[model samples]
Target: MQKLKWGMIGGGEGSQIGPAHRLGALADGHFELAAGALDHRPDAGREYAERLGVAPDRAYGDWTEMLEGEKGRSDRIDLVTIATPNSTHFEITKAFLEAGFNVLCEKPMTMTVEEGEEIVRVAEKTGKICAVNYCYSAYPMVRQARAMVQNGEIGKVRLVVTAFSHGHHGDATDADNPRVRWRYNPEMAGVSGQFADCGIHALHMASFICNDEVATLSADFASTIPSRELEDDAMVNFRMQGGTVGRLWTSSVAIGRQHGFDIQVFGETGGLRWASEQPNQLIYTPVGGRTQIIEKGEGGLHDDAQRLSRVSIAHPEGFPLAVANIYCDLADAIRGEIRDGLPNAADGVRSMSAVHTAVASAKDGGAWKDARPSIFK
Candidate 1:
């Protein structure tokens, strides 16, 4: 297949996410890095973009410059990925979508629910795609889990329990690290920290796998490190619109945990489990049967799972490949193919609503609050 022209904003040199975006976007040969505003600094961004093979003219300084540069080009980029900071997502996504470009924005999508709602409106008005990078949802086994729920293989989902926790920031000494500090600073990370960062991923996973939207939630947040203004740990209890019970725990201070994200779904007739650490397998147990491990590339897997499983069974397709599945879906969507599993602006806004509601609930002593955005409500 011919490659789609792609551009990117942020995810510059030394950025934790930059390499992943580069690798994922190009991995399946669906997209070519044609333009970029890769760094906050003009010279650095231009230099890095050139090193990454973006042409001199297309390697712009910042998002605004890239927007104007790409806007009038005869062969402008078919899509742009916004991997910038959380605060800039709303503005950049809105601008690109309004300019008649498809976008894949990093999660949070926006710092505020209002901003998220506005982006949703703009995308609708412009008839453009505004996808959020909930890439974990694109994992092959996760797709299998979602498929099982939709096919009633697990019966009606009764509950979902999930967590996205890590110990990288547990030490007090790292509290002052610029990378660690900004995540808890209100000015940078916005209203909530761990809950907004890792928690939403888990929450999204629950909604994704259960094929239900979160309706209401109660939460408890803690700033385990006294110096931080936002919570480093959070526990949330939620009810899905379909009455499925949900529980999520996310923390940056859970010592010894590494990329600790996992989810389990309980249903009337069976239970299913999957973890990021073991992305290739889904554990399953029927109401009265032995537990089975469903491998990603095994026979009888759902079409979605099988289609996205690039390698053979027992082989590992890690984080970047999960992200590549997202790009694959985007490429198909851009070509006028309907991909129901692709996460979009609606999903983005819902997550923002949940984050804000969780913040309010945590502050109010874990009082339950509606989690849907006002527009959805």
Candidate 2:
């Protein structure tokens, strides 16, 4: 089997997303961490390299330099994993794609729809593998939900509901971690704070499971905290293109919650509910029967879900392992193997549009409009 050598663009010391990327990449063994440009800070980058045991010569202060210098090395890197702030995704990703390196990037594709379109253009123009880290798509139970819905096991999807809230310490005075830094900075995070940060994931989860996109939406949003520049909380209502009504409440200041990304898809015959906190199993309830707790890596699941569920049932698989599925699948794609299910730039564009629509609607007093169309198809 062809192997993929990996490099990281961010996840330096004290950064939240980077280490998560590193862990996911390492978890699957299909890829190797051969090089990295962990942070914009040189000292921090070096320290991260040491901590990761990456070679000093392959580490650099900038991702561009690493990409340019490594281009000719046959054994260096086949794929680049980006964990940078929202503002840098477009430019950095374009460079890497044009350089013929596959990419697995963080969500909220780019800061704007135009940039998102351009990223899709380049990825298609290059014919190289490009994927976004929508981790829920990797969940075996999530796959089961998607399969059941698409295969008519749930009949027509009636409504989809998702709730993602995180009462983060970012806005708290007593607790200040670097993880909350980019989140509070509008320059780095762009417009609509925590919604884009984590809401993007929830949006993707809902759509991925139902196999649809938002047609129209209305939203209510607030910063909550007086001094903060970004929205700490929001409420969004929408209808997917196929007439499936939906509602979402994404917040960073919802007290008593921690990284909550949960969804429920209701259809004519039955429904399924899944939560990020509990990735190991999915709740399936029939119209007249009791709710069946469907566990991953078990019998009676779709072939794709079974293959991705590498760990045995009861051993448990959550956030990190979900990401590992993406890592392994993308690596397989990069190496010229075809995987059954993997989220690509097309998923990114729809998610980007959903997020932009939610933000715009909230800003306009919960006004409704058609969500932006995907540029991929």
Candidate 3:
């Protein structure tokens, strides 16, 4: 199969996520970076595009120009990845989908639930694939865990606990610190701060692993730094559609935990545990039985897990490789293959709904609120 031609929006020079997307999208050589509107500034955009080896003519100053330029091109990009800030995702994604391009966008797909719904509607109307970068779902162990739960290896799921903790934001940021100002600013990061940034991943991980929808939830949020406009910590309690209990905690202000993402699911007869810090191992225990550690790419693993494993079990694969899996799956999907386990527009909607509900629950003094998964349907 031919490599897909791809473009990007945002991810200018020095931006964290943009380069990751580029590297991940091209990791397997299934895609080529054909164009991009890499920055808001014309000079910067052109420079950044050149830095990525994009042809000068293909690089545009802004998304509008990129869309307009690609519209009339004989060799148009097959897809565009949006690595921009939260506030800008809706317009960029909607515009691309309307222009007949598939989109792979960053999570919390839009700033608001309404915008997410609109994106979903446009995607369905256009018959274009819209994937959200819920990259954790791409991890081999995560897939293995999901498969184990689905195959009844753990019996009926009874409870789940997930968390994402980081110490990067533990100290208050100075207004002049450009690195994290947008994240602390509501204008850029939307209503929920740490939760929107990392909590959504936790939520998605649970849902993806359990194959269940979060039915109702209550949340509490707090900003450790007084100067910040949004919360740096969030705690949520919820019930899944199948009556499984769950709790999620996302905190950027945690003093000692750095990227401490972990999830443990307990079922009627046994339990399973996986942590992001150690992506290669999965711990499973049957009732009254000894614990077993499952390694990625090892024998006895599910085919889904083995398929996602890029290298041998001992050879580690982390975030970038997980992202590459999504990109590869997108390429398969584009080529008319049955792509399972890829997060699509509906997942995006459901995730954003979880965010909105969690924020609302926090605001309403921790009252239980519905996540409204029905919106995806």
Candidate 4:
């Protein structure tokens, strides 16, 4: 088993994602860090590299230097993880992919639809593995839900309802909360704002679970918080490919919320429901039967679901483990054992399209359309 030598372009000293990348890459013992371009500031970059245990000289101040060095030491970096702000995702990922290194990027793949679509084209040309981090797909039970939906756990899928909200930064800017200041800025994060931040994750999760394309719908969005230039709430009504109606609500404003996500599906004979806040269980109820709670590592589990229940049932697996699963699956892709699917580049484009459309509608006082599907194309 050849372990992938991994390098990170962001997630340095002050980076929210640096520690996450480290933990996720090491979770399965198949990847090890070799280098990093940790920060925009030279001193900060050097400090971040030292903190991550990279040899001082291998740490570069900018990604360009890291890319040049990695090109020469292809043996040292089989893959690069881009965990930077949204705007930089395009440049850092484009550089590594063009240099023939595989990429596992964070969600909302690019700041713009054009950039997201172009990234997909480049990946195809390079033939390198590319994936976006939509962590919900990594859940053992979520994957189980996906399989059940496809195998007809419900007689025929009819409706999807989703809600995702968090009480975060409604009254503050990244300036007020240093941790989120960058996300508040259009240049650093991109134009979609909160929609790009967490809404994409929910939208992608629904698509993955159902394995169906979202065809058309109308949407409304807003920046409900005072002095915040970006949207804080959004409502999307979707007509899925098979005429399954879906209503998705996303917000960073609903008071006292913390990473809340609940997905429910209705069909002719049964339904599927899962909540992110409680990752270990999936709710299944037959139209005429008692509801079932499908715990992550407990009994009544399918083989595929149990296999991904890598941790003990007694030991809870939360966001970090979920993030690690993305790295794990992408490693499988690099090994030629799988294809990119968990909110990969194409999904990013789709989400961006939806975000842009909702924003456009908001500006136009809530006009809606169908032809504007989510995605870069």
Candidate 5:
């Protein structure tokens, strides 16, 4: 199979997400990083590009320069991954999509619902792929959960309870940290902070695994750190299609907790529990039966789960593999191969809608609000 030529924007030196994107793109070998604007500073970007072993001629100082340079090339990038700040997502994605390049963007796809919808419109008009990186959905057990929920193994999901917590932001001093300034700045991270950054992932995961959509929500949000401009914690009560009720608690200031992405879905006949910390195995309890640990590559798993598992049950697959699976799925989609469950632009809008509406609900004293209307049809 021919590898697709790939380019990247952002993910400069010391950026946590940049290496993850690089490792993910390299993991499947279906795409190659041909070019990049690794940082805003032209010199740093070029240096970083060279460090990544990219040809010096292909690296550009900024996104516009890279796009302009690539547009004139015979060996143009087939796709570009945007790992920049939340505020930049709209313009970068639009530019690439307008240039007829497929886009894979990190989430909180856009800062506003209108911007996210505009992306959907542009992707539809361009006929190019636009995927959002909700990487948790790519986990083997997550795939299993989705399949089982859809196949009635869970017998009609009636409720979902999800919590994602991290103590990394617990330090009040971080409010003034130059590194995380964008996270606390509303203009950069948008109207919401912790909820927009981490809560949406939990929201998306619940809907994804349950094959449901969050219809409406009531929310409470707080910025625990003094002088912080955005929220660090959020509690949302939501209802999904077919009467599935759920709650989501997301916090960046949960002292002593780190990477606590956990979910529980209960149906009439059984329930399933999965956590990011224990990604390779799912805890399943059938009504009136003993609890079971369903590991990856084990029997009783669906084809979707088996297909995503890259190693044996005990080997353990986590974040990098999850991202690789997303890249692999994107590669399949780009090749026009049959694939399912890669979060596309519409899904991105769904999550962004939740983010927006949750902020609105919180601001309005926890009043109920409807999520963004589904634009697909």
Candidate 6:
């Protein structure tokens, strides 16, 4: 199969996410990096794009230039990934989608729920794919968990507990660093800090695994460092549309937790647990039976899980490969195949609504608030 031409906006040199997207997009040989407006700096972005093997003519200065340049080309990119900052997602994504290009946007797809809704509508209107990078849900074991839920192997989901926490920003001294400071700055990170940054992944995972939507939520937020405008820690209590109780804790000040992300789903018949640290195994327990470990790539795995599993059993596939799974699904979707699990613009809007609702609930002393976006309602 011929590789689809791909372009990227932002996620330039030194970007934490740039390498992952590069590795993931090219991992399966489904896409070639044909164009890019990588860094905020025109010359730097052009230079970096060329260094990454993007043709010099396609190595543009910025998103606008890339857009205009690609718009006039007969062989424009089939998809574009937006790895820009949280605030810029809406503009870049909307622009690209409006111009008839598929988009894979980084999370918190927009800064506000309204923008997110607009994105959803635009994607629908343009008949373009506007995928959100909720790539954790693309993990092979997570796919197994979701498939199990869908297959009734787990019966009715009763409760979900999840967390995404880390201590990289724990130091008060480091709080002022530009990298760390922007995360807590309302101007940069918007309404919520840690929750928006990491909690949504956990929240999305809960919904993804249960095949349910968050209906309502109550939240408590805290900024441990005091200098920050946004919370560094949060606890959320939520209920899914299917009546599943949800609990999520996300923090950036938990000193010992390294990449701390995990989830446990309890259902009427069985329970399932998976952690980012142990991405290969899904721990399962029937109500009255011994716990079992479901390894990825093993026989009897659900088709989605088995299909996404690239390495042999016991061989680990880390974050980038999970991202690659997302790209894989995107490739199929772009080729006119239905990829039901691929997170879309609707998921992005719902998450924005949840974030805004969580922020409001936190401000209201942990009062319960409707978590669905108005459009959904």
Q: Write the per-residue lDDT of candidate 1 for residues 1-377, one digit (tens) a residue.
A: 78999999999999998888889999999999999999999999999999999999999999999999999999999999999999999989999999999999999899999999999999989988899999999999999999999999989999899999999999999899999999999999999999999999999999999989999999999999999999999999999999999999999999999999999999999999999999999999999999999998989999999999998889999999999999999999999996989999999999999999999999999999999999998
Ranked by TM-score, the better of candidates 2 and 5 is 5
**Root-mean-square deviation of candidate 3:** 1.4
Model 5 bad stretches (over 4 Å): 374-377
For each candidate, the alpha-carbon lDDT, in order, equals 0.95, 0.81, 0.90, 0.78, 0.90, 0.96
Assess candidate 2 and give its lDDT: 0.81
Provide the TM-score for each candidate, comma-separated: 0.99, 0.93, 0.97, 0.93, 0.97, 0.99
Top of the candidates by lDDT:
6
Worst 10 residues of 2 by lDDT: 169-178
Clashes of each: 0, 1, 0, 6, 0, 0
Query: Clashing residue pairs, candidate 4?
Result: 174-180, 174-181, 349-375, 349-376, 350-374, 350-375
Residue-level lDDT tens digits of model 2 in 1-377: 54568888887888867767778888867777888898888777867876787888888778878888789886868888888877888888889999888888888768888788888889999998779888878888888889898898889999898998977643577334656655756787787787787777777777888888777888887877666677777788888878898988888887788868889999999999988888888899999999899888778898768878878887788677788888878877877786756888877877777778877887788999777655633
| CA displacement after TM-score superposition, residue 168 of candidate 3 (Å) | 0.8
Q: Say which prediction, candidate 2 or candidate 3, comes out ahead on TM-score.
A: 3
Clashing pairs in 6: none
**Cα deviation in Å at residue 173, candidate 4?**
9.9
Segments in model 4 whose C-alpha atoms lie over 4 Å from true places: 171-182, 339-341, 371-377
Q: Point out where model 1 deviates above 4 Å.
A: none
User: Candidate 2 clashing pairs?
Assistant: 11-18
- Mark the regions of model 2 whose C-alpha exceeds 4 Å error after superposition: 169-182, 374-377
In candidate 4, residue 73 scores what lDDT?
68
lDDT of 5 by residue, 1-377 (tens): 88999999999999989888889888878989899999988999999998888899988899999989998889999889999888899999999999999999999789888898999999999999999999999999999999989999979888999999898888876667877667878877788988888899999999999988888999999989878889989999999966899999999899898799999999999999999999988999999999999999897789889988888769988798899999999898888974788998988888888888888899999999888555742
